[model samples]
Target: MTTTQRDHPSIIQADGEYLAAIATGRFYPGVLLFRSPDLTRWEQLPHPLEQVEMPESGIVLDPDLSYVDGVYHLLYGTALSASESGFADSPICHVRAPSPHGPWSPPVLLHAKGFHPSLYHESGRSYLLWSEWDHRPGRDSFGGTWAQEFYRGTRRLTGRAHLVRGGARGARLHRRAGWYYLVAGGIAVARSPHLTGPFHPDPHGALVAEGGPGCLVEGRAGEWWLTAWPEGGCALGSETVVRAVDWAGDGWPRVGDARPATGAAAPVPPGGARVPAEPGSTARADGRLPAEPELTAPADERPPAEPEPLTHTDDFDATELAFCWQSVRRPPDPGWLSLGERPGWLRLRADESPASRHRVSLLARHQHQDCEFTVLLDAQPTHFQQLAGLIHYTDHTRWHWLHLTHHEQLGRCLAVLTSDNGQLAAPADPLPWPNGPVWLRALLQHGELRFTASADGGSWTGIGPPLPVSRGFLGVCATDLTGARLVCDVDRMSLRPLSSPR
Candidate 1:
């Protein structure tokens, strides 16, 4: 996977176009959706689940999308408790809609057996597939892939769950040329003549032996393609990549070179040729797909141009926040966040402490590469309980904060705080600031972090010593440690990349 901070990508062809859904992990609105015409150049669609009320510290994981009989089914797991060993009490849920851009139905509970749930449909029947988590001592946590019958009309699962394939996780079932192929974690492939029978490992070995997990899809010309995320040193996290799949004479699929390539041929031709729909397809008339841009190159001839580094500026001029901004653990509640309250500024009411996982007034976007983030903050705290500033956040236990707070001796001041795995420390003494809106900036480059502040927008002054860090979310936050609801106004914010990672 390689672009724009996405994970566990699952793509399927629907209505002559390709659709993708990915896990949101610790963020609200469970899954993110995207559409493509040529298997490249994706446009983000409206999220399926808009408002999800999860348990405290619950996270959405491994979302999978599939289309059948005019309805698009989305399957995902919500992990209520997790540790380094494995997840506990993770429940798989299901939702369906007429289209990916949807007013989706409420999530229906499927089972709590495991995570990474996927739906497989055949002969007008649907089956739920997932990796079974084993907690026995001295045994692998990933027991195997299990399958059970799912009744769409009744909206419930029936029959006893049974193991289909063992020794691998994230197993996806596909049929090509009269053979059932089980691609597990993109690391191994097994074949079975029957859908629920003994599966044998491929004699030619796995299709992709290296890199991250992948999903296989057929192209417009009936050729095979692999949508995968190859592991590497990337600041933006894993990115989605497409590779060509070769079929052996013995009916096995193969990715010629196991390594991720920088470029590959386009799956469809210049005019965005549509794939032929399956036989007896009953797609609804209202399910119109998005328009695809016309390209100039022929199929398998030229690759699409690589996307440039991300740069964005938010003046809080719009009525609602853009899709790029995401809050931690919960959706941005209007009760604590507002754009119309102030004409041109964003008003954020302080929530719980920064260390609290339940609720925190923080809004951030993914940091894709070496970049600089600047914000104009206007906040005045009567005591040391309130803080508002820029943060480079990985999670609750790890982050770097450059905040403005009140000090007993120094009055209103600025300070730098660091948290490594929940161990908190103040790296620099507080610096007194004059009463007014201040421009705070954070520069992240080559795994090091530095902070600077400016009275005006031009001249900058360093505040804290350089500290080692890693790539994560960059955003502004306001918190009141004493539980008093204080307000922080952000006039403007911007981000620009210092260097691009190709």
Candidate 2:
């Protein structure tokens, strides 16, 4: 199966369709949802918690999705604070909706003991599972997976929590053939005859020792698939990967050779259509066989074409910001961002410096691959405090900014400012700017970044020396460090991949 450019993906087959819930990290509109008729293709749905208030620090972690009793339940954890030691207060919250495209219920606080909360349903009862966090010195922080009775109707927990099995970083539970399988850290598996009990680890050790945490999903044909991410460093963050699963004669599950394959046959036949679950039927909830399959193509045929590259332009022609755009820590407030102020332009009133996590006005999208991000900015900064231009941002402390700011020596100028893990540096002198709207571009290729400016969008002049860096979220930003809300009008923005890496 093909991988997805999303983090901490929790997938489930619900209502005859495949639904995936993605961890949004520090971006606002928490918990992105995607729907797929067949596992090979996916389309993003509206965020479930777009209006919910998010924490100002750390990130919104593991979001798990499940379908129970004709309702879509979503469980997520928010890191309220963290230090060198570990997470100080991470609260697990729950919400539900009738459909994947949801009018979700308000979040209900579950527990603060740990994160990566997942839910398991059986025989009209539900259980909450998580990796217990123990912070005492010399103690294993994630030593065991805990399970407790969860009353979904009241949105609360009952009875005492039990240590069911060894600690799993991102624990998920699946029941098959009267045996309960506990998949953890996306690499190991444990089994037990009871829902919560003394579990036995797989004698073979880790299922896929080289992959990150993920969940197990059953295909339309009763075949099980494991979803995971690569363990090594990735420029685009942790992505969603799916691997074929086979059941051993002893009932234990094994991933293919414990390695991630570059390509594999999709779980469903090409162009297979989804068969919605019958209303009031608990068949899907209890691992019952799905209705007869509807195969649109032969099993030997190749899967659908690869998805198109992440390349698009925003002229601010629409009244609403596209779903691709996201803000840090908070949703883009209409108070500072407006498209109606000037038709065909995105009006951004600077709120606070990029370093301020509370109220940053920066809006950016994930950089899936090396591409050129260009923006047309029409701003005249009276002082260095008011700046506007393109930014390749990972977090506040690690980013490269090629902006138009006022300089004491060169009045209005373009300069490159970089922060490598909070150590700030200026790699090039400020280049004097011409007055009217200017075209700013950032070319990212082959682990190196180069900045240039153009007057008419034709002839380009280098603004800074090429700097080696990793790929990150690329977008336009305007900041007012002086606390005097300055304004910057972004006429247009475009992102396209280079023909080939240099």
Candidate 3:
């Protein structure tokens, strides 16, 4: 079944807005950001670091944002994959801006060691926290939690780094009742009466809340709450959960029943702000909820915005590209990925030489594992290695793609190619290319994938047997990507669930 798509949920309350950031790895220009007036209905804001680039090859994972002293500070982890050898460490970087929206400063290196970095501030003191990986032969388990004094304005670390705890991620800190509560992979505590310390785990040393890794936030009502991303919600991706927290007699925050909150609760703000009256419904027309609103209006009269659909269809009818389209690393180069150049069609200029994931002229949307992605491609490739089609891309190392290209010997054909690690699979039987508009579709259900094509948008025909699907996601990445150019016009694209009627 389909599920609400969110993961690595990092959220904080700032500037009277609850800003939530989720990890969108390898989908360059990743990290989806959402802001809610109340806490329930989150609307996606323009990705803050959509244009930020890292050196060489790496993925940006688990970004954290905190607004301090009239500036919004963003920090994220960038490193080569663990599978890659040599200097295996992910370094965290920091960027700041006057506002969460727009004109962020360039990324500056911070700490090095592991991924999933977070920022915590207490009483005018800033701290940068991250996982520490020790890869000296026998340190197999994940490294412990480490912290260092951070200067947001200067984007530099100060003083000596300290090992706060062991073997954890998403390490979070909050102070209450003179206890510095620490929740990393599991619940822990440090009663040092100070923000930074010689912290210690709970006396009981047992997991208080067992569902998933999450952070703690106090509500307007002086009650503490916990938010986590529990697994096994859906086939698509991870889901967000919020729960109430209580303090125990032993001085530890008693995170009540590990079960994720599936119901409404008051938000974490002053004056008792609460979830929206309707699920996924914006509290105000302009996304600004009055401190107090007259609730005399009927539920049916409220804006009937439906829950976000898993499927979307774009016909290239608008002058501007849809917000779903994002480039791999930085902003999409207008020279390669353009809309106005082709009137009603989206023209993607496919270069002959394959470039890095960051430089390809591909615009793609995040796709679930069990969904159908259908696109109408109108292309006329006349040279070898000149191809254009749909890509099931996880990253540069792992992917499966089906494209239409031409060769002097093979003429026009359809090829399905798959790659894992760095080994490439030879393309499958080259199917005879059909004339006119080529409609290509990728049917990914559970763990099975099938590629189909049609002369028209309807009346489809299978190109080959169903191939085993990878846990990877669907995106567009092409090769034969530089030097000479091949233009492919995408007429239309649509995504739908497998069980749903077409």
Candidate 4:
């Protein structure tokens, strides 16, 4: 699937020559048509359909494109009529062209009335299978009522393709041994002698795999496999892995070869991972992803440009988030983030807390393994105490946050990791860096958190003992502790993964 789109995942780098989807800026969904070679390098073909203001209906999923007979066919999820999730919610929308490179047809809202749609053509006629959702509130985020709502409540959209009405997501199928066997997310399988499934569910593949509710399909290599993301897993917001799917003596779909897709012919180093592909787009590595200099943003921050988020540029540049900051608000604020108004400064305005799980307010990307990053913040809030620094957090209430701020008693910028059931956890020791202004450094060396401070970028002072944390995204925050107004001014920041590139 495409990565980096604003709402639905954007298709950034594609198969060397096609750049299907892209982001115009950090805002609005920008779709690009790209071409690539060897999945490492990419080149953007002209734009097919670029929507300036993508409607925010949460009902409409991002549109996906694929080449069929040298022509392009775009499948997107859009709102037919609003409900718990429309027939078009996760269902498929259509846009086609006679040729791969051409003027795309207007998006056709092709769907039956009540199911969450997934587009695929087993035989000749394209099919849209989906589960209709009952989006009324408090209906259990997972389990129970929600399941019942999804089951009984979900009806296939009663439209043209009535036979393909049995879609409820998480389904996959492939060609092998003269069979087009299918598997849905609930771990259920339906077998069809042919593609147009007048299929029957095998008792076995009714439910398997873990994590959360997500759609899956055979891998690029067509091996028995699947990958899942948490329910409402904000499109490509999380790193999803591919796992192998197995089969029983009776052709029942089972989990097998569950390793992720590398987009490359080779595999990633141990513990490293990649986001598997979906029906649309292929993966490419050495392509046009921002020249991530130990984690920095590309100068062209708009569409047609890529950001160096975590690609290892080795320098933070103040404009980048130092790979150690994660957002921690329940209804996390999207506006609470920005980079490069001043080129080398990371700024944080105030934002609302997240509402529940997966809804983090501040921005948190990844930090490398056994690394060191310097974080420097220069700010004094008028209303609330503006806090900014790196973190290794899990959730709003879980994990640890190591940052700099103005402590009430100390009356100076202090370095601390606040983690207590109640009240902010005090610094492991008093502020180590000079009160006024200085460079704060935290090193993740062999699982130990060693902190050092420098008044000038050259000199240094030890903060204290290293803090300990699990392998996770290094977080950063710009919270307004007192008023609804916390802001931070930063001089500079940088991250260096001690190990050399492989």
> Which 10 consecutive positions of candidate 2 have the poorest summed lDDT?
266-275
Better of 1 and 4 by lDDT: 1
Off by over 4 Å in 3: 1-4, 81-86, 135-143, 165-167, 186-192, 203-213, 219-225, 231-240, 248-307, 352-358, 407-410, 426-428, 498-502
Whole-model lDDT values for every prediction: 0.75, 0.76, 0.64, 0.43
Worst 10 residues of 3 by lDDT: 292-301
Candidate 2 per-residue lDDT, tens place, 242-334, comes to 778987666777787653343433222123211223454333565343332221321223333344345679998998898778888887777
Instruction: Output the worst ten-in-a-row residue range by lDDT, candidate 4.
Output: 144-153
Off by over 4 Å in 1: 84-87, 231-233, 258-309
Ordered from best to worst TM-score, the candidate numbers read 2, 1, 3, 4
TM-score of each: 0.86, 0.87, 0.79, 0.52
Ranking 2 against 3 by TM-score, winner: 2
lDDT of 3 by residue, 186-294 (tens): 4444444444455566554544434445666665457666665443433443545666676654555555554233334422322321111233332345433223211
* Top lDDT model: 2
lDDT of 1: 0.75
Q: Could you arrange the candidates by lDDT from highest to lowest? A: 2, 1, 3, 4
